[model samples]
Target chain A: MIQMFHVTKAYPGDPPVLVDINLDIDKGEFVFLTGPSGAGKSTLLKLMFLAERATRGQVLLAGRNVARLRESGIPFLRRNIGVVFQDFKLLPTRTVAENVGFTLDVLGTPRDEVRDRSLKMLRRVGLEHKADVSPLKLSGGEQQRVSLARALVNDPALLLADEPTGNLDPALTVEIMDLLTDVNARGTTIVVATHDATLIERYQKRTLRLEKGTVVADERGAKAARLMSQTA
Target chain B: MSVASKLAYFGRTAIGSIVRSPFVHVIAVASLSLALVGFGVARIARAQLDALVDALGGEVELTVYLAEDAAPEQVAELEQALTQRTGGEVHRISPAEALGRLATQLGEDGKALTELPQNPLPWSLEVRLPKAARDAEALGELSRRTRALPFVTGVDYGEEALVRLGLIARALEVASLVVFSLVFLTAVIVVSATLQLAIFARREEIEIQKLVGATDRFVRVPFLLEGLLQGLLASGLALGALVGLVRWLESSAAGPLAFARLDGQLAVEWPRLAGELVGIGCALGLSGSFIAVRRFLRV
Candidate 1:
């Protein structure tokens, strides 16, 4: 679970990326952060990932004040949260299996276990056949799945994805959503930031919508939106 | 990762990366070899000159000639007077022997010189001093004192050879110093640039490692160790080159030293040359590693 109280992040030579934003995510809850472009979606994900600091206010992850924690403690926080980037920042030099096992490598997991676990996850993502191939040579959709497999390999308590399906075809997008749903059903907290209106409508998860660094709409399923999603 | 795990990880990466870069290794090894060559040449030249100085050690003997018809008592008086004045031994150079030695030296240039009439050479006293006696001023003063002795026609202290050899010694020292300084400067630039480029290539890796919970020292150790290993390899290569150079010098003794007039065995100081090569090789290795590591670690 993560909590951000009045978290505002400002960068040099630019306006504040996130305004006094207050958000709380309870344990085991699947939440969607739906917003337009430049609405602080990536900035919000970065704050949670400890890739950048909030200029003001507190961010607590798993009951620990991450905003106030030392830089040395950030790795411990990151280890608990698996993150997927929009571009699926996988090392091109590594094979699919090696990519998935990198998280375990960071944890100092034993060699045989890292191989077995990574290979198992690759099988789940239907990339078992591509296990020996470099991620650079994989298609966009295949690469995205590899990233998702890597993130979920450790079965982190919290999973965060920044536009995971942004570049995928509709079919691949649905496949990834189903994968995320399965991970969530197995008790991983999932928070996805995306602007795909139809997908969000279909999924019908609780949404936090942001516009211009402020939360413009924080709501449950609205009347017309709910009916349109059920009919679809 | 635990310390051991991280160390093993870094060690594998470092070795693997270096082995992959043959061009860089070649350049580094060449740089090391070149620096050692300068050191080797300087060392050998210095040893040779030092040996020459030691072997021929200017406690020189000047043969002071007597008038050819001088009486035995006069020669005795002169010898006594010369010894007292110079505070050293003065032995008589028999007229027959002095003539014979001169004939041998001048005779090499001509058989005609040996056939000259009645060997008109003078009996002389070979005045010798302890090894402590050197320096132009002191030897000149001793020469003047001997000239004042009875029947001492002149004091031949071999001043010309002493002056010329002194100049040669000074010139060798200057040449060696110039070579040493140039090579040392080259090494500094080469090592610093290598380390700087290494730091650049691995900038993101270093940042990622730091984020993944590496301490500053742990982050630094592998690169530092890489530089150290490079230095050691360079030292070995340089040492081999230097040893080959020395061996070649001894074999070809055909180089400039072979042409030099000094007794080859007496003038070539093998022990001193060996010591110098060892010192220079170790110094370059240690200093290059230290400088490379310190420069990169600062940031």
Candidate 2:
């Protein structure tokens, strides 16, 4: 769960990127943060993940004030959140399974469990057979799936994705979205930032539209909410 | 993973990275080994020089020869004058005793010395200064004062030459320290530069690690391991090179240049010096890795 009140983010020599913003995301909710280029969508997500601090006001993640968090505690907080990027961010030198297991390794998980869970996650992503192959050799769709597997392997409570499908073709875009929807159905909160209007209309998730550092509209897709409840 | 497993993982990844870029690792190792060799050589030279100065500076004595026709009384007078002037223990050597010493020095050719004209050697006085009077300036003054004795024919102490060599040895000691310090700093910089390249090559991997909630320490340990491995390998190479150099010098010590013979002067404290070199090598590696990680890896 995340709550931001009167959040403002500004950079030196530039206008405010996100100003006077307020929003709430409940546990297990799926959110579509839609905005044009440079509309502060990514910046908003950054504040939630503790990548950057708010210029004004407060950020609360799961009832903890982020601004007051000590530097040493940041890593522990991040353990509960997963992030995916447009570029996949997979290490080409590593196999798909290693990529997934990296997060578990950082947590000091047992070796046997890490291997079993990583392989299990790869199977869920329909890439179990490709687990031993280098990420460099996988197709864009497969690579994106590997990235998703890595993010979700730790079973984080919240997932923040920035333009997760910006580089994928339309078919692959839907493939990733369906995977995200499936993850949401299993009770992980998801916030995806994008400018793809068609995808928004098709998925029909709760949408928060931003323009010039301000939230212009917030539309809860009622039909999508009903579908999610039925799946639960 | 367990702590043991984590350490194993870090070690494997570090070795893998090094293997992936063998050329870069080789170059780094070579540069570091050369730098260490320079430092080792300077350190050994300074130590040897210090030992030599200490050995030669001890047991400093002067030998003054009497005129050929000087009377026994004159010799006695000169000996008494030397004792009073230097406050040193004086031993008189009669001309006959000097001739006997020459014959003994001739060894198997003592007969040839006996065949010479009768008692050609002169009476001499050996002045042995106490430890307190061995200062260069004091010895020089004493030598000058003894040469002015009317019955004295010649004075020999080699004090001036020893003083000059001591000055050169002192200068070399300072030079060696400066050279060692400079090379050590330069080696650290070289290591830092090399590691920067390695870090840049893995920037994407690092970014993904950070994204997956890897702590800064988790991300840094691999690079630190890599630096440590490089340093260890370089130090091994340097030790080998130093041994070979010492052996080669020892083999050639029998050549015409007598001064080139170390005469066991190069028998350094091997275990201590090796430990120091290894310690320094590790320090250089760790320092460079830390700087690189701090500068480039924001996490």
Candidate 3:
């Protein structure tokens, strides 16, 4: 769960990137953050993850104020949150299994358990056969799947994916969205940031549309649910 | 994760990084080895100087020449006084024995000494100072005391030479310390720079690790281990090279050319020396990586 109250972030000599934003994301909710480039979607996710501090106002995660967390406390807080970067951020030299298992490794998991859990997560992402191959050798879709596996392997309470399928084809985008939906159904709250209107329209999840750093639309997927209900 | 598993992961990552970048590793190792070798040479030189000082300090002797007109009682009294003060055995050399020693010094020309009408050499008491009393100041004090004794003509202990030897020994000690410190600092800098390069190369990976909930310790321990391994390997290599060098010097023309035959006595204590070098290597490695990681970890 995440809550942001009137949050504003700015750099020196520049206008604020995000302004007076108030938002709440409940547990196990899957939400889409849609905007063009520089609409501050990434900045918002970064604030929740404590990757970037808010210039003003308050941000809370799971009832804890992120601004009050000590530097030493950041890593433990991060352990409960998983992030998937648009670029995948896979260590090119590491194999798919190693890349996915890196989170557990950092958590001091045993090697056998890490391997088993990592393989199981890779299987969920349909990349089990590519576990031993370097991420560099994988296609764009496979690489994104590897990133997803890595993010979800620890079963973190919250998942933040920034343009998870930004580099993939349309078909791959749908596949990734379906995987994210499955993960949310399993009770991992997910927040995805993207500018791809088509994917947002297709998935028809609770969408928060941003323009110029301000939330302009907070649609609760009622229309999509009605359409689905009629189709069923 | 257990501490053992964390340590194993760190070690494996360190080795992997080294294997992945052999050229960089070689450069780091070579620089560290050169610095360590310089330190090792300084250690050997200091040890040799210490042994020389000990040998020379033990051999310091004072010869007291008795006045020609002095009576036997006065001579006996002076000998007794010197024996008690010096805490060393004394040997009395008669004038005839002194003449014989002079003849031996003159070599084949000693027949001329035998042709003299009378033995002109003065009777002397050679007092060998105890090792503890052999310092330049102590020997000078002893000489001054002996000169004030009745029936004493003069005391000869090569005072100036003793003073110069003491100065040399002190200078050697100070020089060794300075050289060791400078080389140790150079080694730290070399290792730090080398580690900085490695960190820069892996900056992206480190950032990713941080994003993936890795603690600063988790990210840093591997680099520290890498630096430590480099230091240990470099120092071990340097020690090996030093041992081989000492052996070669002892067997080659350089052995006889050296100031002192640096055989077993002047050689370094291998076990202790090895332990010290390795310890220094580890310390250097840890500090170097620690410094190098600071700039990169700000992200």
Candidate 4:
């Protein structure tokens, strides 16, 4: 579960990026936060992921007031939340398998388990043969899959992706979305921020539409029941 | 696992990565090793020379010039004063004895006695100190005090001996300073460069780990271990190299270093050198990690 009440964030001498925004999502719900450029979607996701602190108000993640969490505790709090970036921030020096194993490595997982799980995840991403190669050597799509494997490695309860399909071809976009759908089906709450209108129109999932740092609509129709049931 | 064990685990991961690219790691280790080797050699050499000089103390003597036409009473009084001043147990070769020594040292043709009528060599009290001929400070102080004696016209410290002792002292002082600076510079370079590499190589990994619920300490712990390992390897190499150098000097150019030897060895205190290397390794390890982690942990 994720809840944000009247959260506001601003940089010095700049207008507020997020202005008194309030929202909530039940356990296991998959959300696509749709918005135009500069609509504070990424900032909202960042706040939820604990990458950036709320300038005001409280963010409660699974009943804990994370907005009040100290800087030292942020990393521990972030363990339960998975985040994927548009750029696929994989370590260039590390092989694809090593990249995926990083989350478990941070958790001090046993070497055997890290190896086995990393190999399995790479197999799932259809890049098992490329496991020993650096992520930088992989194609953008393959790298994205590696990033997904990395994010999902720790089996986080909450997942956030910033424009996950921003660079993918339409067919690959469909594939990536299907992959995300599969993850959601397994009951991981997902929040994806994107500006792609066609993808939003096609997926037909509950959309949180925002403009000028405020949510304009929370939409649902034919696919609402499926969306609700897909969550845990 | 505890934090330290977790650190060791991650440290193993990092070293595995580094060793997989053996060339870079080896070169890094070698550079530090060579620097430490040079430093250790220089340090050992100075210590050996100092100890050698210290052991040679009694061989050098003060030539005490007596007054012309000095009476036997004045001579006896001077000898008594000299003996008492030199802590009573000191070597005081009389002037006649000095002539006999000159004759023995110079041989028959070297005996100037036949050429000089008044036995021209002064009635000197050859105060042979029981210490080595290295530093001029104590000798110079003695000369100043003896010059104040009435029967003692002047204290003639062999000019070459004084000059040589002064030179040795200066050399020892300068060598210590230069070597210390060099070792310190090497440490800084080793630590700074090692940390810089860690920062650059793991920049993205560090950022990602932070994003994925890894704390600053978690991120820093492994790299610190890596730095420590590099330092240890470097120090080990340095110690090995220095010990090799000393052994080589002792067994190879035994003649030259024979002029200066400490504990019967050429250069370098092997045991102390080993300890110093290990100490430097630990220092480099902790210092490098501390600096790198502090910088990276900053927003």
Q: Which ten residues in a row have the lowest lDDT in candidate 2 chain B?
A: B256-265
Better of 3 and 4 by TM-score: 3
- Cα lDDT of candidate 1 equals 0.72
lDDT of 3 at A138: 94
Please, what are the lDDT tens digits per residue for candidate 2 over residues B165-271?
A: 55866687788778878877887777778767767777877766776677889889998898888888888898889888877766776352236344643756778
In the range A1-232, model 1's lDDT, one tens digit per residue, is 8899999999999999999999999898888887778999988988877778889999988898875787556667777778887878776645789878877767777768888999999888889999989888999888988888888889999998988888789987898899899999989999898877777787877778888999766656663246334433
Cα deviation at B107, candidate 1, in Å, is 9.1
Q: After superposition, which runs of candidate 1 have C-alpha atoms over 4 Å from their true positions?
A: A220-232, B1-8, B18-188, B202-229, B240-253, B259-299
lDDT of 1 by residue, B37-99 (tens): 666666666677766664555456776777656688978877786676667787888877877
Highest-TM-score candidate = 3
* DockQ for every prediction shown: 0.17, 0.52, 0.67, 0.54
Q: For model 4, state the Cα shift of residue B46 in Å.
A: 3.2
Cα RMSD, model 3:
3.9
The TM-score that candidate 3 achieves is 0.89
DockQ of candidate 2 is 0.52
Which of candidates 2 and 3 is the stronger one according to lDDT?
Answer: 3
| Over 4 Å off, model 4 | A12-15, A167-179, A222-232, B1-8, B20-27, B48-99, B109-175, B240-266
The alpha-carbon lDDT assigned to residue A63 of candidate 3 equals 90
Question: In terms of DockQ, which candidate is strongest?
Answer: 3
Sort by lDDT, top down from the best: 3, 2, 4, 1
List, residue by residue over B250-277, the lDDT tens digit for candidate 3.
Answer: 6674544355644433457999889988
- Scored by TM against the true chain B, the candidates give 0.66, 0.66, 0.80, 0.71
Q: What DockQ does predicted model 1 obtain?
A: 0.17
